[model samples]
Target chain A: MRVNGAEVEAAVDPRTSLLDLLRETLGLSGTKKGCDQGACGACTVLADGERILSCLALAVQYAGREITTVEGLAGPDGPHPLQRAFIDHDGFQCGYCTPGHLCSAVGMAAEAARGVPSYVTADLTADRVVLDRDEIRERMSGNLCRCGAHNGIVAAIAATYAAGPGERA
Target chain B: MNPFGYARAADAADAVRLGSAPRAAYLGGGTNLVDLMRRNVVAPATLVDVTGLSSAIEERPDGGLLIGAAARNTAVAEHRAVRARYPLLARAILAGGSAQIRNMATVAGNILQRTRCPYFYDVAGSRCNRRHPGQGCDAIDGHNRDHAILGGSPACVATHPSDMCVALAAADAVVHLRGARGARVLPLTELHRLPGDHPEIETELEAGELITAVELPPLPPGAASGYRKVRDRAGYAFALVSVAAVLRVERGVITAVRLALGGVAPKPWRARTAEQALLGAPADPATFRAAARTELAAAVPLRHNAFKIELAERTVTAVLADLAGEAR
Candidate 1:
């Protein structure tokens, strides 16, 4: 599979998960394994730009896909825009769940840009992007912050993305 | 997880051919199966990756929708056709798992996923008949506030946990299946079986029979639909009681309606009795309440889950009333 923009190859056990392949074999530990079961969002990673839980994903099943982990968020210039906003907004305390939250928020921005509707969205007929506080909280419901830094995290996400029209200032 | 061989099927025929081997299983996105495998609930010898198969969500010529089995929950929920015509389906999918899980879970996996009964997952401590037939069910008498209140046998009271299937059932969808015996179709409402003496036999599909697609039939004229779920939290939790309804009313009277429930029965329950009760009744809260009562008249609740009886009634009533209001 392609890891972070580079093509890499490795032989793996049939039961090896994508998370294990990245952490154990490929030496990318930025993607933390919290629950290993799908309950926790700590294993969130992007495959072909869509967020998925690497712990439940078998490595062999995603042989030809492009995977982006927390490490891929930065460019040659510096940290991604969302990363800078996260630091400015104090998005973490102990900093354990920040990686998953950041990755999930990145993917969520793409989803919002493409007009994915959450349960809280008032209209479901057409493509609509309203990245308000409620929408952000609903979209980021999967990624939990145990350190109770959600207000700042939501603020970081809101400040990073342009809140669509009709959003509160 | 246990070691297993994996192969990606080229198509339906290839999947059936590769899956004909004993102990071979079809792997969708593996949100639930992988978790179960980690818990040692299921171990298959070979896994046929059918994600390469049909994942198309095509518009049928008859104004219905044909969703391929491999279509991700996110795709189907976000499809323009589903949002415009089948809002119940789109809403149900959104009301389901978190964004990551919905992105990974497939249409077929959602239908075939197991129950969330605590006893069934407690492989190391609790005895569950669904896990091991004849082992006796601990939920029947133990702490089972979430167990099924209807259509459960003494052997098992586990409730099927798919929100999408309930909407499909309400829409009168049909499931397409393929196996060594060729292809066949069954109503979505009849696909899952009620837990009888054999709670382990959750589905009617024969060994190696793979679900290829689900076809949602066209709704009646002027029918308006919606899905409502009541859970423990505002988001990201299994439903304690959910109602999906498609209703048509004319001149303040019910003309046509279809109802299905989740988190209450062993399968996605087709609320036919409730529909019959509301067929000609006035479109009002009283009519909805009467129909809900008729539907739950046969429900037998467990000790800790008696509250489900009232919750299901109120939810069904509220959902139908909302849909009826939309129609009028």
Candidate 2:
């Protein structure tokens, strides 16, 4: 099976979730286990370039899919633009929920490009849900921050508004 | 988690065959099932995977919508026809668990998901009738804030957590089930039972009876529906009080209405008294308040959950007001 674009073959339990594979079996500690349950977004990762809760995802279900963890976000040269914005904005304190927040923000940006509507979308029939404070707060409501870094995190995301279009749907 | 044998059911017949086996459970998205298994809450001997079945949303020629059991919550809520015909269902789904969880969670699993009582999730052998039939209930006098206010008995007080289910009950949706015997349909309102003596038996579904589809018939003209829920937290939490209301008005008078409540009952609480009060009455703010009071008059809340009565009334009024506004 391929993970994060690499081909790796090894034995794994059928019941083992993707989060277990990342933190325990494969030693990808970047993905924190805030709740183990899907309530908290601390264990989020990108599956086939779409954000998903790794804690609830079964590893066997992604036998031939691409996965991207926080550790895999940085290129050989440096961090992604969103990562840099996060640091510049001090978007993390304890940093437990940062990975999930970052992944969720990336996905949110992509969703905005695709014209998906959040609860904060003022006009229900609008082609795109405007990326505003209220919209981001509502869309990212699932991702909880223990240190109350939501303001900075939202700022970091807002700072990248001009980074051009991202993946949609 | 205990080791449980796994079996993949290729189709409906195969699933029913496996379900007939003693202590076998049907696995859909595994969002709730896996969580329960890990906590040792449920120790099924065999898991029959029913996710492989063709349970997509199918549009009936008569303009009704048939949601398959395998359809994910996200897909069902986002379906074009569901949005146009039944916005209440879509709003309820959006008000449920997070997007990632919704992506993997199926409509069938949402209805069948077990209780959210903390005592039930307690793997340290806490007293819970739902977890252990003969054991006592710690929530009777404990942290009962999230407990039910209606259709509850001394045995249990855990509230059903599905927001979508509340809307389904209000819409008069029919639950489709498949078993070794054959296919059958039960009204969504009858799918659940009061706690009474057997709190362990939550829904009317028999052992190994798999839910295949849920059908929602076309609503009457001028029919408007809305769901309102108030929780301790804003999002991703179970409701402290919730109400789903569908109203049809003609000539400024309420023609027909269906109302249901969640997070305040063992099953979705249908506000029949409220509907009866609203029938032939003018659709005004005062009339809505009177209907809400009538529905909540018989509510029996525990010490911690007494606040739910007021909350339910307020939620019901607010939902009705919104529907009335949409009609105008």
Candidate 3:
């Protein structure tokens, strides 16, 4: 499987979760394991550019798939746009959940771009999704911010993609 | 979590062959199974990965839908046909776990998910009949606000946790299964068994049976359908009481009504009695309330869950009233 932009290989026990393989084996500690169970989205990562919980994900199930973590959400220029937006919007206090928030936000942005209808998305037949504050909160509900920095997080996300072009279904 | 052997099956045939391991279980997106594994609720020695099978969502020429069991929950909810024709299904699927779990969970896996009852998950502290047969059920006299009020037994009262199953029950969805006995189909309503003396045997599937697909019936004209879930939190929380319904009214009369409930029963409680009471009745709140009360007459609630009986009636009446208004 590819991690970030590089091809990576590791021999892992079948019990190894993608979170364990990343934090314990591959040395990518940016993805925090807040809850080994699936309740907390602190271990969120992008599999094939879609958000998924790494703690519940079997490392073997994701073999040969591309995984992107917070560590890889940058260009040669520096921190990714969302990362910078998080800073500008003060999207963190203790910063424990920021990494998961970053990756989840990126995946959520793409989902909105794809016009994926959320539970709160009123019009199921609508061609475009409006990424308003309601949309951001509902889409990112999986990732919990314990520090109560969700207001800032929502601000950052809104500033980034709420007004951006959404996808037509 | 115990160490387990893993093998991916290319198709349903291969899946059955691989599932022959004595303690083997089919693995989809590990949203629920993994958590259960970590909690020691189930410790399978072998896991047969079945995601390699068909994940197609086919909009049949008959205006119905056939969803492959391996299709992701997100995929099923976001499909154009599902959103347009079967909005109840789409809404129910979306009402479930957050986007990440939906992206990881499969159609069949959602049907087979275990209850999220705290006592059931507390392997070390609580005695669950499903977890350990003959060991008493603590939920009967324990903090059982989250337990079942309908179709419960002295042995168990755990509610089925999938919001999507409630919609399928109301929609008359058919589940296609392949097993050692060849192939068969079961109505989505009949797929799950009540926790009557054998909560361990949750589903009607024989050993090594694989759910291949789920077939949805076409919606009737003049139908207004939706799923309404009441939960503790606004998001990411399991339903406290959910109502999935489809209503077709003509001249202020209830021509057709399908209703099912969640978070109140061992299985998706299809309110067939309520539908029978509702048919040909006025599409007014008075008739709706009466029908809901009639359906819930058999509700036997636990100590902490007695409120659910009244809540269920109110939810049903409200949902029907909302749909009746929409159908107008």
Please report the candidate that would top TM-score against the real structure: 3
**Under CAPRI classification, how is model 2 graded?**
acceptable
Q: Residue by residue across B97-118, what tens digits does model 3's lDDT show? A: 9899999999999999999888
What CAPRI-style quality would you assign to candidate 3?
Answer: high
Indicate the worst ten consecutive residues by lDDT in candidate 3 chain B. Answer: B13-22
Rank list by TM-score: 3, 1, 2
Q: Per-residue CA lDDT of candidate 2, range A29-111, in tens?
A: 88888887778899888776667788877676566678888887777778988899899999999999999998877776775
What is the lDDT, from 0 to 100, of the residue B307 in candidate 2?
Answer: 85
Ranked candidates (lDDT, high to low): 3, 1, 2
Instruction: Kindly list the per-residue Cα lDDT of model 1 for residues B106-218, writing each as its tens digit.
Output: 99999999998888988999999999999999999899898888899999999999999999999999999999999999999889999999999999999999999999988
Candidates 2 and 3, the one with greater DockQ: 3
Worst 10 residues of 2 chain B by lDDT: B75-84
DockQ for each numbered candidate:
0.80, 0.44, 0.86
Window of ten residues with lowest summed lDDT in model 3 chain A: A160-169
Pairs in clash, predicted candidate 1: none
Q: What would the TM-scores of all predictions be?
A: 0.98, 0.94, 0.98
What lDDT does candidate 3 reach at residue B81? 90
